[model samples]
Target: MFRLAHISDPHLGPLPEATAWQLANKRIFGYVNWRRNRKGVLTTDILDNLITDMQEHAPDHLAVTGDLVNLALPAEIANARRWLTSLGAPEDVSVIPGNHDAYVPNARMKAEEAWRPFMSGDIVHSGSLNFPYLRVRGKIAIIGVNSARATLPLMATGYFRKAQARALSKLLDDCKEEGLFRVVLIHHPPLKHSTHWHKRLIGASRFRKTLRKHGAELVLHGHTHLLTKAATEGPHGPIPVICVPSASQGLGSRSKPPARYNLFEIGGKDGNWQCRLIERGYSTEDKVISELGNQMLSVPNA
Candidate 1:
């Protein structure tokens, strides 16, 4: 039982040319703030009903915790690399880089040139510290952090770069603490007690003192598009800070209403290690948005 999927901030847009000052930041005016309020701004029919409700919930591993695009628009990151290649075959899928995809402090090489065609062969350019990258698979250890840089105009701040917190403390001490389920994908929100102060994450208390000195049990994130709950006392303990919302919303406005995705299921029981949260259900009759039970557990994890 190793399934996990948690989408976030799919701000793909109807780009025509908005010189990427975060599309003229009226709090990130994506698609001109959904034409002044709310209407699913860049609708490929709501990203084809969230890629047909995530290929009918076939989540073995998919975590896109970032604003795919709204204005770091090299054509909205090439339509967010065709919405992450229609949600599949990018080695299942795993992405990171929020804060409007680094609005041009060299835009992290323009988000690897519009996400290198849906992360061609899982782009892990570990220039050692630039944007914190590490991706293991077997027992699962994904640590992709690059809280998208380039700030100041209206200042939506974020930064986790104490050499990516010591390269996430040597990739969580070389992941194999007997069980191996150290998933730490970050797109900002490394603790602000639920962010604010002009949108926090600037060193967030040195990233919560390096997640209490490397004991990440799972610290997934997505910039406060919403659905946020926080925690942080982790030396292999209480550290569940999962946030998910904005799978496709220029401004259909949901501080925490719908647009969901957070399914996980880790294993290794008796020896002590478990996880939950698989709730994915959304239907719209003929308009169709179905996803029912991939081993249901609608939220049970302190």
Candidate 2:
């Protein structure tokens, strides 16, 4: 069985000291948000403990959906790189950026430089990184799409442009021909109602149409910071769209739920695959990572 672990929206905190110039644009708003709300809820120690617990299960590979940093400050970007390296080698882990990574106009470029290893795909494109990239591990083909892009203040929308959506359709078709368990990874859910209007993924209809046309075994996403499970119609059956909460959430006097991650045990042949999803989250009461629930995820043709 391929043990795949999924986590998202760490939003690693402490908000590394920002220069006045750095906080000049959208970052000023982000800084305030971090200081007022996110700072108390998320912490580096919480994230560290969560990673240690996640590695305890010995997952074959890890998929981080996005939001590795907040404010997109230079120090924050640098620290996020270190965190990613400590998590695992590039080949053993896959990542996609979040809106926070592109908080500012040119922050995305800096993030790309720092996170190239984790985001690089097998087939390289010229100039800059392209979406719909593939990484074949065993019989599973991990497909990552970049929806993270710079947006106006107070907006965290993701983009799936016409070009990327078309390329993704082709990639999904190719993976189907090869009989691989395709898992689509993105920072934002593909469905329209998955998030608020200001934080929705643009061109969601096009994305769903591609999947409904081609078909995939599973779809993993983040960005809403909620533990959610929904489905979209595929050619064969309903595609499992799973989302996890922030990985660094701390439970306080009246705080939110603790950090969580999903472990998927995938096996069986291409058309006859089986996946067992285990939702595990940190228990503040016990100070341990315990299983919240376990169920058999619906395979394409189970």
State the number of backbone clashes in model 1: 0
Q: Superposing all C-alpha atoms, what RMSD in Å does each candidate have to the true structure? A: 16.0, 1.5
Kindly list the per-residue Cα lDDT of model 2 for residues 14-116, writing each as its tens digit: 7778788888899898888888888878877777888888999999999999988898889989999998999999999999999999888888889988998
lDDT of 1 by residue, 15-80 (tens): 545654645544354354546744444355665676577667677879887777655757667667
Instruction: Estimate the lDDT of model 1.
Output: 0.66
- Cα-lDDT of candidate 2: 0.88
Which residue pairs show collisions in model 1? none
What is the Cα root-mean-square deviation between model 2 and the actual structure? Answer: 1.5
Off by over 4 Å in 2: 253-256, 284-286
Per-candidate TM-scores read: 0.34, 0.96
Q: After superposition, how far is residue 47 of candidate 2 from its true place, in Å?
A: 1.1
